[model samples]
Target: MHVFLPDGKQLDLPEHATALDAARAIGPRLAQDALAATANGVLTDLVTPLPEGAEISLITKKNPGQAQSVFRHSLAHTMSQAVGEYYGRKGFPKEAVKRGVGPSIENGFYQDFDLPEPLREEDLPDIEAIMREIIGRNLDITRADVGKAAALEQFSYDPYKVELISELPEGEPITFYTQGEYVDLCRGPHFPSTGKLPTAFKLTSTSGAYWRGNEKNPILQRIYGVAFASQKELDEYLERLEEAKKRDHRKLGREMELFTIDPLVGKGLPLWLPNGTVLREELTRFLREQQFQRGYQGVITPNIGNLELYKVSGHYQNYSDSNFSPITVDDEQYMLKPMNCPHHVRIYAAKPRSYRDLPVRLAEFGTVYRYEQSGELNGLTRVRGFTQDDAHIFCRPDQLKTEFLNVLDLTVLVLKTFGMNDVRFRVGTRDEGGDKYVGSDENWTAAEAQIIEAVSEVGLPYSIEPGDAAFYGPKLDFVVRDVIGREWQLGTIQVDYNLPERFDISYTGEDGQEHRPVMIHRAPFGSLERFVGILIEHYGGDFPLWLAPRQIAIIPIADRHNPYAEELRAELHAAGLRAEVDDSSNRMNAKVRQAELSKIPVMLIVGDKEQEERAVSVRERTPEGHKERKGVGFDDLKAELLERYQTRA
Candidate 1:
């Protein structure tokens, strides 16, 4: 059989030879380093027989996808064996520790087990020691295919494995990988042997998981671990984990008193405290001004609309699972708006439009609700109720690309304003043969092409993702990397022909005939709640002067200087700044510490000298330390604060 290499070189090999045999034929070094292989873009294990005339690319430590998955999967198998061995040594039979599925996920792997005795966090070290010992044995790992009857008999004692094997389609090969006495039923692309697996792994934690993520299914203990190619990488990841813990928005939000989730209010519904509300208002004002300057007219819509509106938009059919149940009002059903576009569409359909109103942009800071699962809800990033800085542009077909580019520019500006400089784009197009999409083929093709062309014209780095588009249209999502190197999807712009067609909305063209108007759906800040959550983590709870809820805290040295502190705060408030006076009878040093802990950006100290000079002593927070500039005139201080607020410095 002839097989092609990645470099276009062809070689003849035995008919049923595996990828490892192909690697050996190419070079000994490649065979030794090979972790997995990709044949015609499908990842496969080296032990799998290569197809005739296939295109093969050997995956080593250099490749991100297959190498990581292969090694991590192998580590999971090793960990499972270690667990069984540990139980066996403790007088329990090895068979008593039944293993469930173990799969390689991003950055690590996890395995589910049904053991006679439950595992605890304290047992992780002993398991690690056993894993290391198994690795030292350098046990050979091999795969084998078995028929249904043979597989069922082999795994009859393990109910999880039996259930999995029973569900396998007929005529499909059942495969299992074995290392020493530990065997797992998996269709795997795993490393050749235990010795080849990296030891730079640490079992992180244990949690309960249903066998197949179903609540009705039996619960299993899941052990989570992270593996890296080298010790240095592991160390770096651990350090980042520590930093992430400190920057967790949920923890920081409570400490800063920004937002809270109350049991009475229900899960996934966040109540913004006064401080968080200020942050929200400032962001809304900034975006509203930007939209106004760009010729967008603001609009308001009710929080609940008739169910028929969503039915026309196809959101009801596609997103009902994630949407709250309909409300029965006078025997007619209404739904809490899951999106703003449907309501905005009705506004466009309210009156007949003309070609001269070709690009009608309607903007809203609209709040919408969704029935997010409890497990998926985080502090504010994933919420039941949130606001979107949403807008929809109705334009002539000829203006599609231009309108898209304008939205793209606005999105870039929003990201930069938030100091999210590291940005990437993804153009989500429909799957070619998928039935889930609602629009016609021609409309899908045209909308996707326009998005790609607009992104190309902007000269932004982007990749195409199939099957990631919304049912109604293709979309361009802006993913930004935060300060801690975590990526979040913050902004999106989508083009739609389906909604306009479904609603039969049109404008009178110059030729005196009606024409369908294409719709461009965009949200620079996808959700105000999510955006604030990410911002909190991005800034590590230390916001910029303009965005800070409490921009300044004035501290008086003694009760005698309280009047001056109050006066300073009044001046700051008059300057359109959020300021507070520390009149709680606390010492100046304690006041400063409190301000620092609250992440207040600036602190002004007032004393007798400053009171006489009619100035304040400014102490500003910096990366290095508190910077103190003494005897700054009150006028100068106000001007500086105004400058930072205006320029967003």
Candidate 2:
């Protein structure tokens, strides 16, 4: 059989020869450095037999993207071996510790073990030390395929492994990897030897996870660790983790009094505090104005709708798992609307239109409900109920590209407004030969083509993702990277022919005959709740002046200057600035500190001398540095703030 390399070199090898054999054939150094390989673009273990006439690339520590996974997964196995050794030293029988599945994840790897006793956080250091010792032993790792009967017999004492083997399909190969005294059931392409594995790894923590992720199954101690090819990369990642902890939205939300969730109000439902509401309202107002200028007419819809509406939209069939049960009332059924598209569809269907009205753009700040499981719920990112900045545009086929481009413009404007400049696009199209999507193949092709063309015309950096499309249509998602280099899917614009046809909505075209209109579904802010959560974390809860809930804090030097502070606050409010006076009986410095803790954008200090001068001491919070401009006229200060607020500076 012949295998190819990226340089177009071909090598002939015997049948059943693996990537390791090919690497050895290429050169001794190549074989020694090879950690894994890819056969025809699919990552493969070095021990796995390469397909005939396949293209293979030998992965080494230098290949960060692919090498990281192989290294991390191999580390997981080593960690398991270390755990068993640790337990053995503690006087437990080798067979007493049952091992479950372990796999490599983003930035790290983890393994699950059903231990005789629960593992504590303190055990991680010892486990990590054992892993280092195992690596130092230079153990030769090898993979082998075994018969199911023999594999099950070998793991008879471990029910977790037995259950896994039992669930394998008939005739599937059962594979295992061995390193010295530790043997694990895994299909792996490990390094040539343990000595080749990088030493830049640390066992971070341990947590409880159910066997196979099923609640009814036995709980196992899952140990997590992060690894990298170089210590520098690992250190950088660890630093990012520390910064992420400090910027965690949930913690910042409590300190900033942005939002809250209570068990009594139901899980995953966030109650927006006054400060949080101000943020929400400001964002809404900004987008509302943008939409109004873009020819979007706002509409209001009910929280719940007739059950049949979703069925017609095909959401009920596709998203039933994420939807709450129907509410039956007097022989009729209703449900909390999980999407606003269906409601907007009804709105379009309510009236007939001619070619002049081909493009009917309807926008709404629609709140939706989905049945998210308790475990999946986070602060606000994963919630049962949230509001979408949704809109649907029904236009003629010829206008599809133009409408999509317009939606893309709005999405870009919205993202840039929040200073999210590092953006990428993903054009999600249906998978070929898949039954999951709706609409005719011709319609799907046309809709997908329009999206691709629009994205190309806009010259946006994008990649096409198969099987990431909505069930009803293809979409373009705007993925924004925040300040800390975390990516968030913030906005989406989908081109749909399914919903309009499913609802049988039509408009008169130039031919004077009724024709099905193409629908475009767009949500610049995907969801207000999730967007705000990302924003809070992105800015580290210190929002920009335009988005700050309390734009200015007026601190009085003493109680005697209360009237002057109030007068300044009124003037600031009159100029459309959000300002408040610190009326509490506290020292001026304390008041300033409290205001700073609240993350107010600007602080105005009032004193007897300032009142006599009819000027306020302005302390403006700039990203570069905080500055104090003394003896500034109140009117001048108000003008500058109003200018910043208007320009969104």
In order of appearance, the predictions have TM-scores of 0.96, 0.97
Q: Write the per-residue lDDT of candidate 1 for residues 212-288, one digit (tens) a residue.
A: 87767888999999998888888998888889999999999999889999989999989999989999999999998
RMSD of 1: 1.8
lDDT of 2 by residue, 451-539 (tens): 99899987887999999999999999999989888899989999999999999999987888889999999999999999999999999
- Quote model 2's TM-score: 0.97
lDDT of 2 at 65: 55
lDDT (CA) per prediction: 0.91, 0.90
Q: Once superposed on the true structure, which residue ranges of model 2 sit more than 4 Å away at CA?
A: 61-66, 216-219
lDDT of 2 at 85: 95
lDDT, residue 255, model 1: 91
Can you give the lDDT of residue 566 in candidate 2?
Answer: 98
Residue pairs of candidate 1 with colliding backbone atoms: none
Deviation (Å) of 65 in candidate 1: 8.7
> Can you give the lDDT of residue 382 in candidate 2?
93
